[model samples]
Target: MDPRESLIPPETLPDLLAPGLRLISVGLNPSPASVAAQVYFAHPRNRFWPMLNASGLIDETLSPSPDSMRRLFEAHRIGFTDLVKRSTPGVAQLRAADYRAGASALRMRLHGLAPRAIWFQGRTPWSQYLRYTSGEAPAAVWGLQSQTLDGVPVWVTPNPSPANAAFPLDVLTAQLASLANWLARRP
Candidate 1:
């Protein structure tokens, strides 16, 4: 299927979601490359998909395409969404209002879905999310936290954007491995 026909407008990628998900991975927002391609983590250099596979969170080396995402929800019991749905060249282009609105929407969405876990791909959105949900700033920490959204566990991980050279692919892969371990231990 033409991606355009299967997804939201190219300017805004739709959430890849389903009920009763084992995990719901949340990104800060869609990058311009992702928006243009109408695929999540579409940038050639983005490590999101590769890390997921490496960590055994996903069994297949999936591409950032509509079919793969559908399989992620249906077969893997995983879903993808973003704190912000808007497309921008970079996160630097996002404003405070954008984050506030995104956080609010995400809170409601998570509360309703009540996934087993909600994983934030970066510290930025996770911080904003804590503020949005708790009405106070949290000393953000990477990895699983004691926080929960509507009873769903919250996890934070390093951003996988190519621009984030601070955490190399190996580091991100390890982080994802931790997330997989957490999920495995869940009752």
Candidate 2:
């Protein structure tokens, strides 16, 4: 086993998913901090929660925690999942096999759940998903993509990880707001 495997907890993170979800946010994978906190984007510096709230996607602000995630699901019809289920200190620890397996599993979930739309938190998850599932790594631009995943509309946004400082919180919020607008326009 990889030395990093020893550092990861046996339970990484669970997918907050349900049938007929209006939108599902897909991250590259769970960070060690998120796994430890039992919440998605739990790192203190991560901008996901703040950006999500400022985006006007949901009326109330939500902190990174199990209850907040449940609120997003039960109240707003939003959900969360990751391309890879494993928790790693950094993406460098992930292997090609991990992406392949994750992409396969994600494909199955998307087909089964039939979420109205998918919001990929960063380019990596979508690129890896495509490469592993269809042998295609198309250039991914931010915002909604022409391609659909099993007929579900796909949207991309800059990662909210603190490490992705290039995209400030405002930009992330704007991207998410655009997604919310699109969701509203959908029948």
Candidate 3:
């Protein structure tokens, strides 16, 4: 897939979903596999699932099936989104322009969702978002948090892309377990 092509694969790039979506989880962008798989974080090497398990966010280990993820979202009030709606195949396919555009647009989404907490799975997206704002809005940790951001909270976990070297399964699971532990405590 040509990253620069204006024609994005109609292969299921979800639009700006309902702002009613509560726990909005934001990704940096889309990969071809994710687009093709029609599931966010579907890549085999990605650590997203294990992280969720380690974090204790979910009660059971889920198969990387689209249905399971969707079920979890609906039941848990979690939502999925990307900083960029367009597919770029890989990070190298993205330009600085995409980050800037995504950042500007993402802020509007935050206000719209009014989510109790906003979660990002990567440093690029979170660090870039921080560029446009200031002063520790919430407990922005590498894992889950118990704080709020301007009333709404924000948490970040490791990006599960096979490309993100920082979060191998162990690290990723520990991080996700943090989220699970938090979820366990919530009313």
Sorting all predicted structures by TM-score, with the top scorer first, yields 2, 1, 3
* TM-score top scorer: 2
Candidate RMSDs in Å, in order, are 3.0, 4.3, 4.9
Query: What lDDT does each candidate get?
Result: 0.86, 0.92, 0.69
lDDT by residue (tens digit), candidate 2, 1-187: 8999977765678888889999999999999899888899999999999998899899998899889988999999998899999888788999999999999999987786878899999999999999999999999999989889878899999999998999999999999999999899888
Per-residue lDDT of 134 in model 2: 95
Candidates 1 and 3 compared: the better one by lDDT is 1
Q: What TM-score, over all chains together, does every model reach?
A: 0.91, 0.93, 0.78
- lDDT, model 1: 0.86
Deviation of model 1 at 59, angstroms: 1.8
lDDT for 53 (candidate 2) = 89
For residues 9-121, write the lDDT of model 3, one tens digit per residue: 46544733455555678898877777777777778887787677656666677766778667767776678888876787687787767777877777666665676567788
Cα RMSD, model 3: 4.9
Candidate 3 versus the native: TM-score?
0.78
lDDT of 1 at 116: 86
Give candidate 3 misplaced runs (Cα > 4 Å): 1-12, 15-22, 132-141, 144-150
Minimal lDDT window, size 10, model 1: 2-11
Cα misplacement distance, residue 96 of candidate 3 (Å):
2.1
